[model samples]
Target: MEQIFKWLLTVSGGVIAFLFGAWTPMLNILVALMVIDYLSGMAAASMNGELKSRVGLMGIARKVFIFAMVAVSHLVDLLLIENKIEVGYLAMSVVITAYCLNEVLSIVENAGKMGVYVPETLTKAIAVLRSKPQKEEEKPVAPSTLEVPAVVAPNPPIVTAEVKKEEKEEIK
Candidate 1:
């Protein structure tokens, strides 16, 4: 059993090394963000009483796709290197950064849905990161002009304390 476990571990390590070379800090951050996003999504769903196994499975599949794309990007980088191209993992960086930003945005949204207070500046920063530049002839809408609704809980908190206080004041 120990020998089998060791063999499995070695194979898994080999596969990961081939997929992502050296496990750079950026890749580590991307992986961390992916996990945080998924957990936050599940928390939000549970809070809203909307947890579904199908949705969770889909989320897991999407996360796997994200990593797969990252692996593909790394492979592209390797290809460029083999072709004597001077570009330094540009494709991989772009792909990973984009996915990381997306995961961050999803995490923020999930936190908001779960009634956590997220700063406006942080959300705006994410929005700016998400926006693409328009062509010279095209006009871009300012971020300030966008109307974002406030994140409110589906069920408001009961007013028991406030109502009782008001009743006491009336008696006084």
Candidate 2:
């Protein structure tokens, strides 16, 4: 038992050392953003009365896919024979930026839903991060004017003089 415990401790220490040596501030920021986004989504769902444990679990599963996508991007860059370090950093930066923006926006939106009065500056920042510009409503579209063709009636048969005489004889 003692031997097993020592081995486990050694392995855990080795893993921790590796992580600390390879860790970047950007990676930490990305993780923070991911957590915040998840929590904000949960809060928004609760506020909307649509919270479901199974759905939230699925949301988390989808969120985890972002990291897998980033990993795939890094692999692609390596396959392209680019500088692996620069490519990885660039990919991580972009993914982290997008995730951080999404999380912050979600948090702000949830706060708004909860009736919290956010500052105008913050709102503007969120809008810029989301890349949604305010716009005025435009004129409505005119309805199409294509006319439907009318149905034609079948021609009536003409009454002949012979047929009228036959009818008179029958009546007599």
C-alpha-based local distance difference test score of model 2: 0.72
Runs of candidate 2 with Cα error greater than 4 angstroms are 1-21, 80-88, 121-172
Best by lDDT: 1
State the weakest 10-residue window (summed lDDT) of model 2. 15-24
| lDDT to native, each model | 0.91, 0.72
Relative to the true structure, candidate 1 has a C-alpha RMSD (angstroms) of: 25.7
Candidate 1, superposed: residue stretches over 4 Å from native: 121-172
For model 1, residues 5-26, the per-residue Cα lDDT tens digits are 9999999999999998888999
Model 2 residue 150 CA deviation in Å = 42
Give the lDDT of residue 45 in candidate 2: 81
Kindly list the per-residue Cα lDDT of model 2 for residues 26-145, writing each as its tens digit. Answer: 667777877877787788788889899999899788777766665554455555545444544455457667766676788787777766799989888877777866697886665575
Best by TM-score: 1
TM-scores for all candidates? 0.70, 0.53
